[model samples]
Target: MRCDGGKPACQQCVRAKKSDGCEYDDGKGKTRTQIMREHIARLESRIKELESPEITTPPITLFDPHAASPYFSESSSSSSHDSPGTTISLSASASPAPFPIGATADLESAHWDGQWSSMHDFPAVPQIGEPFGAEDPPLELAQMLLEIFLPHRHQCGLELHVGRLRESLTHPLSEQRHPVLMNAIYLWACFLSRPGQLYEHEGLYLSRALAAVNDAIANPAKAVDFIQASCLLSVYFLSNGRLLEGSYHASAAASLALQWGLHQIGRDDFVGSMSSERESTFRLEPAKDSIEQGERILAFWQVFNLDRCWSVALQRPATIPDSKHPWTAITTPWPQRMEDYETGEVDIGPGSPTIHAFFIHQAQVSNAIGGFSTFALHAKAAALLEGASRLSSSWSPQLSTSPSLTDNFRAFEHTITRFTTSLLPLHQLSATMPEDKYSLILIHSLAHASMIRLHEPFLDDQVSRDVALRAARSVTVVAKHIADGDFDYLDPLIGHCWVCAARVLISELAQLQTTWPPANTVDIRGELSTLLFSMNKLSSRFPLLAYQATKVQKLLDAN
Candidate 1:
């Protein structure tokens, strides 16, 4: 059997009564036995020293709350006064710790069996008593939390370049830390911890991140980090059901993205390479390299995707201007995986528009060999769903529908139809990586959810009802896979989609009850149950989902 990497002893060995053999290296050449012997010797020496009773100094706390520690801080002086590559330095707690005692007592050994296994146990509740805010958690604990955060990174946004981030960690913390970004990451890491000590420290990190983000906004050097941190904070709030806070941060991120001209990253250059037809609308600094530039591009889309999708979910107007204004247009290329950026695979020459091009020309540039990736597809899916939702939200029987609006609706429906038809079947979606599977599932689910949202108002019409019914059923089918797979963390907005499907099923069930025989009532009830079950399971970790699941259950009960 494989060792679970449990501390002290692996459970497999302990349960088999071979705990004495469960040995480990202490990172040095010494084995566990050697380390134990040295610890005992040290304890004996400490006892002898205590027996002397000659100590005169009073004992002090291990970590001083008032002590200053080196940390990243923006210079208060004018930006122009600083050199081009000036690095900011500040001091705070060098050993800030959120390590609550007895926090890991309930954590199971098997939970570390694999990366996914560890992530599946979020909010595992190690039962913290009181928090010690004087010291920063050990770097080792931060690294451990980071390992847990990486696999679920996409749940927040795609602003991170994994290879670059991992590489940075190898350097000294003083050289690499961006307080705004690091604290934001630490907040997410704490939130994702499963029965780990950091969970209780989420508030501390959140406050630190928020304060740092405010500072970052004023410092031009920290703009990208500011945007990235805002996106993270937005998702963190939304996941915890703080809609107002989430929306505010999302709006801040989207607005700053426009200010930084992130949406037009390659546009000005791409256009300049071809015809100088377009001049830059926003003054922006050039990225140091493709990876830096690519992160900016991803940052825009991350904000765009979050603003668009969550706007629909929260029934609020989207914050990103998208194609609404010339300056606000998203002419940048579609986002790709960080690896593609590192490999220069996304350098598709100049003048090729991605998001806007896909909408206007139905250009399948994203489907092209090197251009296609799951994230690109997901971006398109978000755009399509948002477009359809906007149209649905505006449509009202009281307002006379214009031919232009009707045509727009038809165009949107046609685009959704084509988009969904092009997707791989659920069974055929890439299953090699679990993250890819999750993305594919969301892509398909969003497509179907769009149909329901678009047709929701006209559900009294037979054709619209039929369309919605089919889409709702399809949602259940895909959601069944999600439930069966036992995914704990998901995009919180997905719960809104689940609620949409449940509403359709509930309506169908209510109507079926009106029929004397109630034909196929069991099937409709079963489908609703499937969606509710999935939502409920996820609700254990996501309070937003719990709220959504409760409303759906009440709807079912009423029906």
Candidate 2:
């Protein structure tokens, strides 16, 4: 057995009750850099030996360079070192290694067999779409998509100047807009687009958006445009049930936000391939305009919220921790309404509150906990869910419980109680509202769903069962309300929360089949069926909604 060469005695020696058998004279007393340099020196000497022309191994057969056919099946049994070769055929066990410095592919370790690999293994490059001008995709359809997008844009973190965007779409393109951002907008439009004509062009928009986005990733210098494009793309992916793609873009956005020094207010972080002169220009002049600076601030939190939400859904670590950037350096104020910016009501550097400032401020206060407005409540709900997810996943009993696990559970419940109680009478949503009940109901449903997630894992406990059952029932009721109403479009994030709620209900239902369910549990197969029907209907527009619907369907079938 080999020891890791621990100090005093090796692990093996320690286990065997030996006192002084360990030795690391070679590794001890050297810094990591010194050890790495020594290792590199040895590797360099080995590479030189292997790369020598005199060190010959298997002889490779050369495919005729002048051959008309692409197929190369002919092989010579034996060949000399100087034989001309076009392709390599190594042993199946041999790994693909990079060519040594100043060495040819066939310099060493090449075999001359005629075995073939399929060309289909390599995917063809995707083609980019033709440029979009005013006349490309019909005007009526573009306008409709923009309308479908605008009302929901702020919720998804769009801070682009709407007036400028409106002018570019309606009037001639006098000033150039960034292609990455332009295509990203077009992509989101395609996502929300309707009618046969609009829906058919999603492929066209996606290809164009992807082409520009790839280029932007290669050099994401202009942080504002890059952040917008990436965040929008991530939201689109998440809406469509493309979680991996969403996570990738979310990570990219977080990385770009940090790299751009958005975390550090008043600091210049030059990125990408800009010349020293251009970089120096940015360094000399920070964002003197408060509007631009505030956009960056809002943009940072937008990514932060996303990072927190999806981290729970995907059961992965969060990308942007709250402590990643201290609050002292990050002094960009919370976002106000986009209209406030257009009207020039809210100044950038903390002068006076805008029309929407109170809502933003209340939702974001550090010490306060409850009785916020509808929008502020929604933001807090998101935060609470994130906290619950992190705490819940931290501990699970492999065989039996421990003090740490029990303590974590208690602390987790305390947080849930605190947040749940914080919702004052004004904050409580009503199911009977006539005009616009869906948004508020969705918010409450999501908050309850969070309660379910935190308590669902420990449903055997009576307290946890009660909380989870209540949350599960609230989800079904809200879902039924939406279905009963004539709402055509559902927010994708709300769809995600409904899915979480359905999963909670379905889990309890599944439990009833085997173990003894809670005494208060009722047979709500009808409720489950209604919720499923609603989800199935919503799936036509929101593709990810189908995921929850299908899962519930399977559970019903199994039961």
What TM-scores do the predictions have? 0.75, 0.61
- Which lDDT tens digits does candidate 1 get at residues 356-468? 66766546643353345677777888888788888887887899989999898887888888888888788765332456677778888889999998999988988999999
Best by lDDT: 1
RMSD value for candidate 1: 12.2
Q: What is the C-alpha lDDT profile of model 2 across 315-397, one tens digit per residue?
A: 67877544422321333334443444445544233322211222233323421221233433454566667767776666576
Q: Whole-model Cα lDDT per candidate?
A: 0.66, 0.52
What candidate 1 gets wrong by more than 4 Å, as runs, is: 1-136, 170-177, 269-282, 348-353, 365-371, 483-486
**Candidate 2: worst 10 consecutive residues by lDDT?**
90-99
Off-target runs (Cα >4 Å) in candidate 2 are 1-145, 152-161, 168-177, 214-221, 263-290, 324-334, 339-376, 399-439, 483-487, 513-523
TM-score of 1: 0.75
